[model samples]
Target: MWSRALRSNLKLSKSEACIFFKNKIRGASTCVEGEPEGPVVKTDIPGPKSKQLLQELGSLQQVGTIQLFANYDKSIGNYLVDADDNILLDTYTQISSLPLGYNHPELLKVFNDQHNMKCLINRPALGVFPGEDWPKRLNGILSEISPKLPNITTMMCGSCSNENAFKNIFIAYQRKKRGDVDFSEEEKSSCVLNQPPGAPKLSIMSFKNAFHGRTLGSLSTTHSKYIHKIDIPSFDWPIATFPQYKYPLEDNQRENEEQDKKCLSEVEELFEKYEKKGIPVAGIIVEPIQSEGGDNEASPQFFQQLQKIAKKNNAYLLIDEVQTGGGCTGKFWCHEHFNLETPPDIVTFSKKMQLGGYFHTAEMTPRQPARVFNTWMGDPGKLIILQTVLRVIKEQKLLDNVLHTGTLLKIGLLELEKEFCYLLNSTRGRGTFLAVNATDSKLRDEILTKLKAKGIQSGGCGSNSVRLRPALIFQEHHANIFLDKFRQVLKEIN
Candidate 1:
């Protein structure tokens, strides 16, 4: 069914089909090396030059978490060169943000074009004074991606995109309940003091181990780390469990389905409980893959059912695609694979999109202006880059590359899991956005650290999972390098 849908949607004729099949069989992308010929390590990662800059930056603000300073000019394609001239294969790609790796000629062309300079220099308060080309740019985005949501609200980043999306949902929820009625004087006056009746008690339901963002409104929905929330006050929003699967997935299919049912039940119950508490949930926010919390995945059935629960309770559904957007997942939007009954009410995206914001349903658009206003709602300069990035993805067919490369990664990891059975398990993810869990947190950290020392940069999430957030240009050759380094580390540990 999925393949048929893909074929139907793709609509390839005989010649197109022949080329795609030929590429698939030959692994055409694997033949093209995107990374530099060799990674060079001239000095320790944070050697002298980076340490000096860290000290200077530390004098201004806290710089404890600073890594080696990068020489962006020297970095090319998938390899990152540090200030000390240590070139490492970068898999994290600036927290999974860079779409085309470093210094792609197409992206560089943007800087060379003088006409785009005006939008970059004279930035406007987009809500009130959008540039003349704003609508045209937005039209391009809508036509290209859209995610089945006809409306859009551009914001500044992941958190604010989700934050403002929540506001849009809340306003639509309220407006549906109170049609043709003006705001009462008492309601307007009381809202100034942040009390109920005027402010109205409403909530957004999020799942356990989710990381929405650090901003106040988004923080209320982020449940991953206590450090991000300990000192800050937050809303008493309903938190449901995201399904935890036992691997190998085929062996644990029945158990995983049961886990899905158990979680979906809790979601329905929470909606009722919150309503009884006088703060009904106005929307549901979730990550397609629970990234940051450890690349946790749920069955497509789980997401489909969860959407039904949201609709049943009249809560808008918002998929937080902050970390999963772009072509890393072999699709422009990861949710495209789910075959959702309908498009989500809102899909918030950032990181690789080059701009942060959301595609939402027309119903979610606010009736009044300034309800979702912000200075520089989104940057036009970023949109210019995004437009270019979209062109590169299509012209190069990067999504096909992701699919081929991802299979190489998944198969290699499965083989590693079999060999290193005692140390790791639960290797999972869609496309190149993959991960494997260590037996324990300490072991996970140790393996990650060792991989870094071996000239491969990786990232960790949750307690025991090592995540792969490679650039869209990550070819199978890069995957083989990572797996080779990874196997060496595992062998040494054993």
Candidate 2:
């Protein structure tokens, strides 16, 4: 029954199903079609066919977090379709990774280009033998979005980008400590055995609820959930408290300022303690807005002071924009909102950029090349896609759209909080990267489940916060549609 309903929803033909790229990709004429007329739901979410497919997938792997199987071919614009044919207005956008939503025309056009096809089919080992055009491609893309930093290093994803960035910090720190001398024979031999004088006891400082990644070095800095770190061996790195601001920010300015002071003080104390213990902190890493840790935010003053603290303690600073970058926060780089006196020593990104890498000042560039190297540093195919995405962003002025829509979302969430005071509070965010807290975890889960059934898919973060990570193309009309459905859900729960 659900399958039949789903077929009706798509209204597609056999040839259309085989090519599947019709209507979405346009010709030499480049005008984009506006947003579709809201979402269309053909069946209940996770209808019978979806349940059977999920059971089959579960037998093959640990499919615990699987929500509904996606019909990638059918999903387009801002709407998502599941195997059961239920269509949802997707606000989560694949854990905040889909930049232009699904199947944007410009992205689809890459398949027709012969050069892009060659790059995709023949992956190169970037460290040893890159294609001749590799350097030119790197310069063009990296320079365009190079934050305030001058150099760029590419990697596979968020985890490895940060893990290698951590290594870059350690290498720079050790090089500074050694001054002009060559490594001692003892130091060289000891390093081979993973010991001191070579391996070193340096560390990276992270905030209490921050998340860098899940690899060994990056995992040491990730503190969002214990389950991610349970059995993995980690370093004894320092973790400072990130400021917990109060709601209706205008009403709690003084208290929020006090919160900032208390957290900054704790960070200083940890730096001193770690130094005294001989495990000097080589770097400090943090998210512009703590997305995984409940969307916690800090004032620009807090980040400015934090950078000063790092400089005073002779530690490098790395800003992880894996989840916050690519204009979700109304700026190309979210940290740009902080108005820091200088760019951070390193800024790492992945997610929506279509690749993972870090930007750094010339001083932070590794003295050795292969020391910070990887296979296929990042795929050329992803760069081709990023080029198209970047073009669309500029031509369409998507950043302006983000701001226009974000205000609507923020205001709506605030009004909802007032209407459902007992159930929610503390709405916060920049641009469309917004979130609000329920009184507790159980209520938060209920809100999320009901929102999905209503055809609006939201995601939760930290403990009790529902985060909004809409695509850059999200507009005022889409925001209104979401607001209306969300209000209806709140009414039912009340």
lDDT winner among the candidates? 1
Candidate 1 lDDT, 1-494, residue by residue in tens: 65454444333344444444555677644322355765666767677999999999999998977887989997878888888888888899999999888888788889677769888998889988999999999999999988988888888899999999989998999888888588889888998999767789999999999999999999999988898899899999999999999987878889999999999999989999999999999999999999999899998899999899899888899999999999787778999878899999999999999899999998988877888988889999999999999998898888877776776787789889999999989988877899999999999989988887777878999999999998888877788889999999999999
User: TM-score of the candidate numbered 1?
Assistant: 0.94
lDDT of 1: 0.87
lDDT of 2 by residue, 67-165 (tens): 889888888778887787777888999999988998888898996989889988898887887788888988987678888687888888999999999
**Candidate 1 regions with alpha-carbon error over 4 angstroms:** 1-21, 24-35
Each model's lDDT: 0.87, 0.85
RMSD each, Å: 3.7, 9.6
Clash totals, every prediction: 0, 0
